[model samples]
Target: MNETDAKVPVDGSPLELALTAWREALGEAHVVVEPDALEAAQTATFATTQRIPAILRPADTAQVQACLRIAQAHGVPVYPVSGGRNWGYGSRVPAGDGSVLLDLGRMDRIVEHDEQLAYLTVEPGVTFRQAHAWLREKNSSTFITTIGGSPDASLVGNALERGDGRGPHADIFQHVCALEVVLPTGEVVETGHARFPGALAAPVFRWGLGPVLDGLFSQSSLGVVTRMTFWLARKQPYLREFFCTVNDDAYLWDAVDRLQALALDGTLKGSFFFWNDLKALSVTQQYPYASVGRTPLPDPFRDQFREGFGRWAISGALSAPDAEIGALLERRLATALEGAFRPVTFAPPPPDGESHFQGVPSEANLAMAYWRKRTPPPQAPDLDRDRCGFIWCSVALPFTGAQARRAVEIADRVPRLFGLEPNLALLAHSPRCLYLVTALAYDRDARGEDARAHACYRALARELAQAGYFLTRAGLQAQEASPSVRDASSEVVRRLKAVLDPRGILAPGRSES
Candidate 1:
C-alpha cells in the first residue's frame, strides 16, 4: 500500500480493518479516509507528530457506541474530539500516534432546556453560538457562562476539560450536573439522578446518592462524554462592565489582595481578570515587527506601552438584582480597593440587553493567537490552519497578592529566555484561588520557531511545577511529561484506567495521572 492509501486486502492492518468495520457501522461518507481529512485532523495550533489515519464522525450516542465497539473489537486506538477548537493546546490532535480521529461535530444537539430552573442539556457537539442563539430565540431569562474561545467551541468539551470562564458560574465544572459517558468497552452509563429510573430532577441535582462518577470522566482518558448539563445564571436587573488599571506592579499585587475581599464578600459577580500589557496589546494588534524589527519585544516598547496601557488591567462585570444593589456593589468595590489601585472605571451602564458578561460569545479574544503572525489576521481566523503557535500554561494559586507576584515573577522570565514574549493574565475563579493563565504565542512557520515554542512550553511547565504550582488544564503536549505525583496516587489512577479501558482503545496518554 502507498503511504497515503487507506485501503488494503479484505483482511488488512489494524487501522484498515477498523476502517472497514467503521464504514459499515456508519455509512462510508461518515467514515472518512481522505488524506486531506486526516491531515487536517492531525494539524494543531502547535507542533504535533501524530498521524491520524482516518476520521469517524458519529451522528449520535448510539452511533458513538457502535464506533467504540468496532474499535475495541479491532484493537485500534481512537481519539474523540467534540468541536476541534481546542486551539493553543492541541486543537484536535490525538495524544498518541496512528490514532483515528473520532470527530463528534455531527452529533451537535440541544437535548433539553429548562428556563425557569436555569439549566440546559447538550450533546458533545453543541457550540456556544448555537446555545446563545437558542436562548435568544426563546427570549429566556437566564444565560450560561462562556469562555474567551471561538464561538464554535463545544460546551461539553470545555466543561469536560474543566475550563473556567466569565460569570457567576465561572468555574464551569462546578455548575455542571448529570453526564452521559460512553466507556471504551462500549458500556454506557449516566451520572447523578439521571441514573435513576424516573428522576425528574436528574439534570438539576449534581450529586446522586452514591459516589460521584461525573468527575472520573472529566480530564481523564477513561471514557468519552457524549452529553452534559450546564446550570445557567439568571439575568440580573442591573449590570455594569467594571474595569481598572494599575501602573505599578506593587499596586497591582495590592489590588489583587483587596479584590479577594470583594470576591469573598460577594461583590465581584463572576470571573474577573488582570492581564499584563502584552496580553492587552496582543488582543488589539499583531506583533509590531516593522516598528520594533525584532521578537521578544524590547523593554523600551513595554515601558512605552505601559505608560498608556497601564502595567496591568483588571476587567469583569457587576451584576445585581436591582440598581440599588448595583450601586451598593459599586461603592463597596471602590471602597475595598480605594488606595490600592488606580481609579476604578465602569462602562456607563448600557440599556438592558444581552450582556456579553452573561454568556454572549465573542471571537475578539481569539485574535491574540495571531499576535506574532506577520500578515494581517483573516476575517474568520482559524489558528491551526493559519499555523499560529500558541499554548496556554495555566496554574492555580491562592487568591493573594504575594502569590500573584511570585507567579508573575517566575512565569515572566522563562518565555523571554526562549526569545518569546510572555502574554499573561490572572483569572479569579473563586474567593480562595486565582488562576494565572499564561500564553506562549509565536509564529510556527518562522524558522526553528516551532521546536523552540514546544521546548519553551516544556521548560515553562516544568519550572512552574517545580515552584509548587501545576497546570489546571493541559493539552496533549503536557500530558506525558507532567510532574510526578505520589506513587500511590499515580498507581491508583493507572489501575483505574486499566479497569475502564483494558485495551487502551480510547484516548491514551490524555490527562496522564
Candidate 2:
C-alpha cells in the first residue's frame, strides 16, 4: 500500500484491524464512523477538500495513549482536536486526508482550581464558559482569560494555537504554566515541575529546572496536550471602555505611536484594538449586497461609514484596582492623545455590563464571518455550523506608525485587487509590536467564490511576507507561508520533527514542522 493511502479499506483489512483495536481501547460508544457523522466532522469554517474516515473520541490521557499506539501499530495517521472550534483555521480537519480524528471534547474536567494562587488546571475539553461558570459557582475572585471566538472553544486548544484574548492576559500561550502532553509514541509526559512525582509547585512555577518545553507543544504537532494549567488574572475593581477615531492617515500614525507609548509605560494594561472603518462597519452590520450589485462595497456605503466612523476606529478598555488609579490611567491616556487626534471619546462603564477586559466571552465578534453571506445571520452566530467562508491571515509588525501604515496599506490595496473588502485590525498585545490581523470573508456555498477567496488569501500572505511582515499565527490554509527548509532555522525545525515524531503522524505539515 502507498504510505499516504490510509483511507478506510474494505472489511477485514488492516484499517479494520486498527478500528477493532480502537473500539476495544475506548468502547464502541466512543467510536464514530457513520457516513453522516464523518461528513459533518469533515466540514470546516473555510473551504477544504480534505476527507476524514472516522473520529475517535478519547475520554482520558490513557485513551489518547491507546489511540496513538493503535495508530502507530497499524500505520494509520491520527489527528488530535481539543474542541474543534478552531474555525476559519480548518476546524477539525486533519493535516492530511484520510487521517483518523482524535477528538478530546469528551475529557472536559476542571481538575484543580487553586483560589489563592489564581490558577486553574483543566483537561482539553474545558471551555471558557465552563471555566467561568465554575469560578462563579465557587465564588472565586478571578476569571479565565477569554477570546472573541466561541465561548465553547477549549482553553487548551486556543492556548496551543497561541490565540489572543481580550484581557491583560491577551497573550494566552505566555500565561499557561504547565502542560500534560501525550507524545505521538504513546508516552505521557508533563512539563516544568509537573514532571517530578508529587511536585507541589507544578501548577505555579513555569520553569522548573531544565530547558523550558511548554512552548514546544504550541503551534506544533509535537504532542497531544491532555491537560494544562493557566494562570488567571485577578478581577479588577474598576473597568471602563475607551473609544477614539483617526479620520485620516495623518492622525492614525500619531494615534498608534502615542498608544504604543502608553502601552509601554504600563498605563495600558489590556489589549487595545485599532480597527479600520470597514471592519467596524462589518461587525455593526452586514454588507448591503443587494444595493451594491456584487462589485464591492459601493462608494455610497463607504461615504456613509466615513461620515459616521471616519477612516480608523479605535476601541479598548482601561481596568484598575480602584477609581483613583483608574482616573489616573485615564488621564495619562488622554494626555498621550491630547492635540494629536480629535473627536476622541472616553466613556464611563455601562451600568450592569461586563467588558471583555473583565474576561467576559461573547460571540458578537463572529458577526464579521457572515458579512458576505446572502442569508441573515442567526440570532446566535455559529460560523462553522453555518458554513461561512472566513479566513484569518495575521502577521506581526513593529509598533510604529510607519510600520502600521504600511501594513494597513497593503491590507487595503491587496483585497481590492481581488474584488474583496479588507476587514482589518491592529491588535496591540504589547508595546514593542502588534499583530496586523486581516480576515477574508466570502460565501462558501457560492460557486467559484471559494477559489477566489483562497487565491486572495494566498496573494495577501505572499505580499505581506515579502514586505517583511511575517505571519505570527497562521491557519491550516496558510501552511504554504512556512519558510523553506533552506533556511537554517527551518531546517532545525524539520530535524526536531524527525526526532520527536519520526513517523510524521502527528499533524503532518503543520506550522514550522
Best by lDDT: 1
At residue 316, give the lDDT of candidate 2: 85
lDDT of 2 by residue, 423-490 (tens): 89999977788999988888888888788888888899889988888877777788666544444876
- Compared with the true structure, model 1 gives a TM-score of 0.97
lDDT of each: 0.87, 0.84
Model 1 stretches with alpha carbons more than 4 Å out: 1-11, 340-342
Clashing pairs in 1: none
CA error at residue 41 for candidate 2, angstroms: 1.4
* Number of backbone collisions per candidate: 0, 0
Query: What are the clashing pairs of model 2?
Result: none
